[model samples]
Target: MKVTRLLGSGVELADGSRIAAGTVIWTGGMRASALTEQGSGQRDPLGRLHVALDLSVTGAAHVYAAGDVTLAATDDHGNHAMMACQHAIDMGRYAGHNVAADLLGLPTMPYQQPFYVTCLDLGGAGAVYTEGWHREVKLTGADPARSVVA
Candidate 1:
């Protein structure tokens, strides 16, 4: 597959085709460009580089966040998991129904996604279908699956 990793404006290929200075156009697969913040126009905000994000999964579990304060927890309940869409859907349902019940003194709906499936859009490259809370991650490539549907 033809891929172009553009780390910088300067193009250099360790192997494969390399474009010339006067080349009209160039193309390649772009993964992650340098993490430059918007407006700042630099990888770091100020002259002092803050460095990488310290992800402490253990500490994250004990601390709970709501609304826009969601963070990643690595090992909550023996499975370090994402605060993802699945969790969002569950949270929405629970929060909405609970609020409604509280207002009218009715029974609040319990929120639990104990048994469910996951569809991960791997950036249109492909997707992974998994059982449980990310227990198994499988890529559906060209073949997709072994058995043909009847």
Candidate 2:
């Protein structure tokens, strides 16, 4: 659902429906910043630059992209990193290490995250926890509460 506008305590949808709530958490998704357009490189549909394993911009020498600005391979099984905080955090770390390694003539490590997990909060109904790209449910209700609360 696309939000047409943000109300005082909720959101108006594109279809002209209004939802009332005490709090609204919008996870509407994101697009890469226009700063990426200033550079020359292949970009994904979201405008993220396609990056090499070491987080360097493909076909753009000495240029690196990470975080939400990059489209990167996450593992050998052909999984790609998503534009989420979880992926961005690790990508940032890898980009930092790889950039320093390249400058100091050290071997750079390829970015890889084979394991994936997700926790979705359902508010008063509690939450759900899943694993893998397919989002296989591994926990729910009290299980997620116990695992995520800490």
Candidate 3:
């Protein structure tokens, strides 16, 4: 199925056709907690807390968050962190390092994850290992080259 445009309660197609949608299930990413709303921290469209370069909450500098809970810019183009382990691992390291640095009166490490990768489990269809933000599947299926190297 191909989608062209979106209507109020329906959608328009490239063939100049309109289809009324009864339900729209957005397959976006994960959803973050609403705890940020209780604080002075700002949240993004996904409800993830807006964070500074040091992974600290924007308004609440004393609080630092990582993983899917924070909406830290991953790139200069304003790409925020995606809800994936690839980002969480790195973000956790940076968050911890920065917090320690702050206590030690040293410079904090800025959060930056320029690389994006995904390993999707396709079930009966096997799996795929993707690379980069575009998520180009570099290795797929039962191919021998698909083995993940440490």
**Ten-residue segment with the worst summed lDDT in candidate 3?**
141-150
List model 3 lDDT by residue over 1-150, tens digit each: 566777788877788788899655556467888776798777877889988888988878567899988888887876778888878889999999988888888998789988877776655577888887788878888662346543
Worst 10 residues of 1 by lDDT: 48-57
Task: Give one digit per residue, the lDDT tens place, for model 1 in 43-130.
Answer: 2122211211122112222111222122322233443223356654555555555566656768654334455456644433655566
Q: Candidate 1 lDDT (Cα, whole model)?
A: 0.38
Error of 1 at 41 (Å): 37
As for lDDT, the candidate ahead, 1 or 2, is: 2
Poorly placed runs, candidate 3 (over 4 Å): 1-29, 144-146
Residue clash pairs of candidate 1: 4-28, 4-29, 74-80, 75-80
lDDT (CA) for every model shown?
Answer: 0.38, 0.87, 0.80
The number of the candidate with the highest lDDT is 2
- Please, what is the TM-score per model? 0.38, 0.84, 0.72
**lDDT tens digits by residue: candidate 2, 1-150:** 678988897889899999998788866679999898988798988999988889999998777788889989998888998888889999989989988988898988888888888899886788899999999999999669677877
